[model samples]
Target chain A: GAGVSQSPSNKVTEKGKDVELRCDPISGHTALYWYRQRLGQGLEFLIYFQGNSAPDKSGLPSDRFSAERTGESVSTLTIQRTQQEDSAVYLCASSFGQGQEKLFFGSGTQLSVL
Target chain B: AQSVTQPDIHITVSEGASLELRCNYSYGATPYLFWYVQSPGQGLQLLLKYFSGDTLVQGIKGFEAEFKRSQSSFNLRKPSVHWSDAAEYFCAVGEEGGFKTIFGAGTRLFVKA
Candidate 1:
């Protein structure tokens, strides 16, 4: 792909429903990251994956939030029993090898929990 | 933990006027600094980055930033403002060889015609 791709650019789900956001990173990218942006707030890191290493999930806000990636290709972030507070933009980014490499971001999935 | 602070929540500047946005960071070791811009209903675009060597860095769209190690600041500047430049700017910091990047709250720029 020319750039990072995210699915379901906009999603409106009822509270307690489950939602999944997908990200297809740039071809050959070795690192992937997930972040959340609330209205008028900064981006909060959710998780990071580097190559075949164990993913860093320390930033996940709660037990309801989980994510998975398959061999550095596509990734999915799943939110179970979503709440109103979960209404925000979910962004995905990828880089060549992490570290100081520049990150390319996707358009993001705007989830609105009604 | 690494953190970034953008003091101003919003700034208004006249078109053709010079502009500057302040940013500060707290990190234990050398940090990788970055500036990104986000237009309404759009994803973020990287403006510039500072990893090593020179303290001043240039970015796309006629923007530049200087890394001041003494103050732990990476302030973005432009010689002249444009109406199209009205967007949200974010400053971010990451540790060397680390995957986590912490972004600031963001500064909204409004350009007046």
Candidate 2:
């Protein structure tokens, strides 16, 4: 893909339902990131994937939030038992490499937990 | 902990008027700063970045940002505002040796014709 691609541009779900957001990063990019943006809030770091190394999940807010990536390609963010506060925009970005490099972003998945 | 602050939630400007968006960050050591713009129903696009050297960094769409380490600020500026420039602007900061980048709340620019 020319740029980072994300799926489920908009989603509305009942509280406690699980939701999955997908991201397809640019080819040959080795770094992927997930971020969350609440209404009228800044972007919150969720997690980071660098190569085959263990993903840096330090930013995950809770156990319900989890993500996975395969071979530096497509990535998925799964939220289990979503809460009303989970309604926000989930953004995905990828970079050629880590360490202060420029990141390419996707349009993001707008999730609304009703 | 690293954080970014964009005080202006919304800014209105006339076409051809100069614009400035304020940003402040909190990070230890050298900081990697970036400016991104997001138009309605569009993905975020990188405008410019300041990693090291050259406090003044030029970016696309006639946008530029100046990194002031002393004040912990990286402000985005444009000499002339265009209708197309109406968008949400964000300032971000990345820590050294860390892949995670923190973004500001964003400032929405409205250009009046």
For all predicted structures, in order, the TM-scores are 0.97, 0.96
Q: lDDT tens string, model 2, A1-114?
A: 888999999999999999999999999999999999898877888998886454589889999998988887889999999999999999999997758878899999999999
Interface RMSD of each: 0.8, 1.0
Give lDDT: candidate 1, residue B30: 87
Q: Provide chain B's TM-score, model 2.
A: 0.98
The TM-score between candidate 1 and the true structure equals 0.97
Query: Candidate 1, which CAPRI tier?
Result: high
What value does the lDDT take at residue A31 in candidate 2? 92
Candidate 1 residue-wise lDDT, B52-111, digit = tens? 999999999999999999999999999999999999999999889788889999999999
Chain B alone, TM-score of each model? 0.99, 0.98
- lDDT agreement with native, every candidate: 0.94, 0.92
Q: After superposition, how far is residue A70 of candidate 1 from its true place, in Å?
A: 1.1
